[model samples]
Target: MSTNTEARLFSPTTIGAIGVVNRVAMAPLTRSRADMEGVHSELAIEYYRQRATAWLIISEATNISREGRGYAFTPGIYTDEHVASWRRITDAVHEAGGKIVCQLWHVGRMSHVSLQENGAAPVAPSAIQADEQVFLESQTVERPSMPRALETAEIQRLVEDYRNAARRAMEAGFDGVEVHAANCYLLEQFIRDSTNKRTDQYGGPVENRTRLPIEVITAVAEVWGADRVGVRLSPITRAVGDTPLDSDPEGTYFYLAGQLGKLGLAYLHCVEGQTRGDNGAGDFDFKRLHAKFGGKYIANNSYDRQMAIDAAESGHADMVAFGRPFISNPDLVARLRLDAPLAEANRDTFYGGGAGGYTDYLPLADAA
Candidate 1:
């Protein structure tokens, strides 16, 4: 007989208008398996379909514009070709009976010259450069030089990028779109102090720093409707030069959360903390963040089966998102439900590779 370790995590639940078979969500993981032009690959299609057991799946970050790209070999949703390629993946997941959301992103100053067009300066709320080294391949390269502050006109254009991407994602057959306003990306850069030091209507003060995010959210909600739109936040993440650590990031997100809660969004994904590496932020107060953001909260960061179950049961998080574990365990949801041991993933084959660790991780019966 099987014990009920998955009682909370595996329980059926609903967030907004989306009905989930369970509360386990698959957080978006950047696999770097796409084509040179950031188009989705067949391998990606298989990888996502294999793990459709989750209540919802947020696809890897897809750059909303060329300048939005921060790495090599990732996918994009800004072009017709990009849309076609992702449609293949979305079609496959739908056939498997799963709901998927595309995470639209813009990297801001955390980009490299190698990833930009003619090495154009990255655009941000201010001219500040995070001045950090980003590891792409074997060697670490200096980030693309600092960017000039985006003009109000340019800021409006970036918002359109998100709007167009959301429209394309829907046309390509996705359930919804999540505006990536976290992880020190472009949106997050504006939300924090270290980066968004501007004197325009879009900068300074809590309300101004939050203007871009709310605008982006409004655009996405308009295109996908509030019911299908969600945003991710990492108030505690100290990526790049972000600062002042929101001694109460919870309060910051609380204000943002309550504002969003009124919009009737499908969900709010809390990155938990900085995810620059496998070992997430060692210092994080998830309970406090959860208290502030009262909607359907999906918590991500080094989660294991029992911890996820406990979080879901205790109401700390409505759902749990697993990243590294899902890399090798395609049947992660099934494994957790059965309390079966999982196959450890091959970190060696993580980025820039074929389908070795991408899709070769076997199911439970095969592992047995």
Candidate 2:
């Protein structure tokens, strides 16, 4: 708990083309504060600017296209309006001396019919319905609609969507982009065998299952360069949709990691366990996975101050990402540096609210 000058967590490091002052990163979080059209509200600029001290701020999961939307009020980066709105946020964060990246997302089968175009069914690798609940425009949660299998020809279009989204991120003034391939989302649905039941090139074998995600990464890397791109992978997280873990998580992810390592990505932002729950260390060998990556690794999920420091000091991780903690602690980096107490966030104001919980949390200097 001592404020030691030698703490690796406080040391400066370069993540791809971006240089950060510390190793603490703000993980992507969904606050549902954007408009129905996926444009972020003006309040988001201040919200992100307040947390600018972190090494990097990964924006909440943003839909890559209209068909990619799952939850209500989540932002998108596929339109000119979306780009204009996000430009304001990126400019604010940069002016405050912080680095930010957009986490491009596509919900796939995790979406409800109400969220899709013309009330169409959600698309997935196969015709499987996730036992997941999605937040509707009415601010209510409902089980996702049954998804239709994506035709093999439609796969390239999904890749193009990711490419265009990455291009928009660049136009919006973001330093980089992170492909959201975790938490049973669209990309993860294809990566995992439990959900992907196709026999085509995108399914069946582990290599085939990971093809679309790899293709998406390749397309995004083409926009921002491989070093400026990161990918989020949850090897064993089944918390999102009650989706079962892949039958061979270690084999599946290790192969994917090795493949991504070949591309020389900025980092593999890994969710070490069940997000918002116990770290499922017993399920997979994270150390081996890190070695397989052969690049920077940003460890996430259930990490405290000491744990983050330990991971950095031991060289187990190049950086650490904190999710919920950053929600209530705008000056999270300072709090961790001083080992100060963190303010608890209100669960009620977590989604679809005004600035009450989003930007009202006072930093330590203001609180004192």
Name the best candidate (by lDDT).
2
Q: In candidate 1, what are the lDDT values of residues 1-368, reduced to their tens digit? A: 22385487887888766778888888888888887688877888899889887758889888998888877888899899998988988888888888889999998887776778987877878887775565454335555567778888888898899999999998889889889988888888888766778888787777787888998899999998888887898877775544335444655666777777777788888877676543343465656655555677888877777777777877878888888788888888899988889888787787778889898888888888
Flag clash pairs in model 2: none
lDDT of each: 0.80, 0.93
Off by over 4 Å in 1: 1-6, 135-141, 239-248, 276-288
TM-score of 2: 0.98
Tell me the TM-score of each prediction against the true structure.
0.92, 0.98
Looking at model 2, how many pairs of residues clash? 0
Model 2, 34-152: lDDT tens digits are 99999998999999999999859999999999999999999999999999999999999999999999999999999988999899999999998889688999989999999999999
Q: Which pairs of residues have clashing backbones in candidate 1?
A: none
Clashes in each model (backbone N, CA, C under 3 Å)?
Answer: 0, 0
